[model samples]
Target: MPATENVHVWGDARPLYTYTRYIQNHFGERVQKLAVDAGLSCPHRTQGRLAGGCTYCNNNAFNPSYCTPSKTIRQQLQEGITFHANRYRRANRYLAYFQAYTNTYAGVDKLRALFEEALQCDGVSGIIIATRPDCLPESVVNYLSELAQRTYLFVELGAESSHDITLERIRRGHNARSTEEAVHVLRSAGIPLGLHLIWGLPDETPEMMLQTLHWAAGLDIQTLKFHQLQILRGADLAEAWQHTPEAFQLFGLDDYLEFLVPIVEHLRPDVAIERICAEAPPKYLLAPNWGLIRNDEILRRFEKMLLARNTWQGRCWRGEF
Candidate 1:
């Protein structure tokens, strides 16, 4: 039995707490996120590190065409705003989403310069930085803390999975402990925090995925993003899958939807879910081809399933009941 006061339903009848509601409540209106590529490289992908970076990662697969590192941050933001404007007409204010690679891999001075450049753009309200837990040194954390005080800021750490064994298999350089420490550090600094998790991975079972969500629910995070593992053409995981398909348990669309209901039900009510699925361009996608089905459609079907089952986020949360 969850506390009645803790239950929240968005205006659109969303059963779970959603990023849209969170944004509307915070900004008093719709605010779109314009993805920007800051031209920073991940430490894991750098020379002399892990050979192929994350086995499942191919940033280009998910990145918007407008988000190219060659373009200036301001230019990218402007283009993104233009691109999103047609779809999200209600969004006048925009948040610069540093989404491509590890955004905070640079020194404080350079990071500040790029962040400020986005803030200087027209209609830009805030910035969301995506980075790895291992990349956040004390210096970077302090700078992020300082930045948060001035304007709206959110730091999203790529936690991927809470299972160290799965993490090792994926070649995600940092362990689960690194994610915990990063969450604690960011929360202590009074920075709003978000976490990114991959649902289906090489050797993760549904129970294992639930354990990761349980771990996340206990964290001091404001938001979470869930990306179903997609086998992309150029990713190392694709090569591995080609050689040994039995090693992975990738989700078909309906199966993913079925799996997500319990996941949403177990999530803490306070944590806004930013995304529940990932959709890469068909050209880069190699497997689990749910043809022409978009993220919004998945969300719609998920919500319908939740309604049919008479459940919402935190329905099965141990902390709540």
Candidate 2:
């Protein structure tokens, strides 16, 4: 657990420790992340390894149209900058976000070349690499450690759930223990770490979801991203839901807000809350439609609820729940 002394001090109007605040504090200015596809494949979806991907994952749902592996890294970065220019006009600096598949699922030399390519791009300040925990072998971790020493780097692991049973149900090749071990390795290397969790998974009750948050809080990490499981059209979960919809506990927007408020209260104050919900393109999304509401709107509503209840992040971290 994080130190509790002065845990309640937010120093801002936001009720939770948001990633935006963390970025402003670290970079001294607003920094935008330009998502780039590295044309990488996951170990779980490879021919020799586990063939099927995660049941709830449809990568196309979250990826922007400009982000594709077909383009060069520099092309993607330039296009991404132009893509977000209007919305984040103040963002002069940017981070090259390798978000598609397992970014580190390659040889150290290849990974280094790709990352350096992005670093060489104009206006790019740093890099954020997202990959599966089991893919971070010692060789990759060592390379990332060296990279972190010179530039801003964040390694986000997709530890979708902390329960081994749920992990298996989703066909996640590795168990929760892989995430724990990866966290330890990354922390030892002095790498800033982030863990991603899916709130609504098959057979995961509200209590189980909270247990995953508690488990993640104990890890040596600097960030957390909570994504409500979305049943996308082409995902394995969608097929299953079609067969038996009652088995899945998909959250309506109101139920999600009610469930998420307590999660914010229980989250460790020092950990930056990167995201609270997932927004898939409506064309790809199958169930639990929130009706054209964007992520920013969802966040606004959540913060309002937090203030109305007079609660904030880490309110229950010291066993106050």
RMSD of each: 1.9, 2.6
Question: lDDT of each model, Cα atoms only?
Answer: 0.89, 0.89
lDDT of 1 by residue, 1-321 (tens): 434444454434568888989998799998899899999978889855789799988989978989898999999998897898777675779999999889999999999999999999999999999999999989999999999999999999999899999999899998999999999999999999999999998779999999999999899999999989999999998998899888778899899999998898888888899999998998999887889988988898888998888788877776742
lDDT per residue as tens, model 2, 1-321: 222433445445578988888898799888999999999978788855555788887888888999998999999999999899866675789999999889999999999999999999988999999999999888999999999999999999999989999999999888999999999999999899899999989889999999999999888889999878889999888999999999888999999999998788788788899999999888999988899999989999999998888788887886422
lDDT computed for candidate 2: 0.89
The TM-score values for the models, in the order shown, are 0.96, 0.95
Candidate 1 at 28: error in angstroms? 1.0
Mind sharing the TM-score for model 2?
0.95
Model 2, which residues run further than 4 Å from truth?
1-10, 319-321
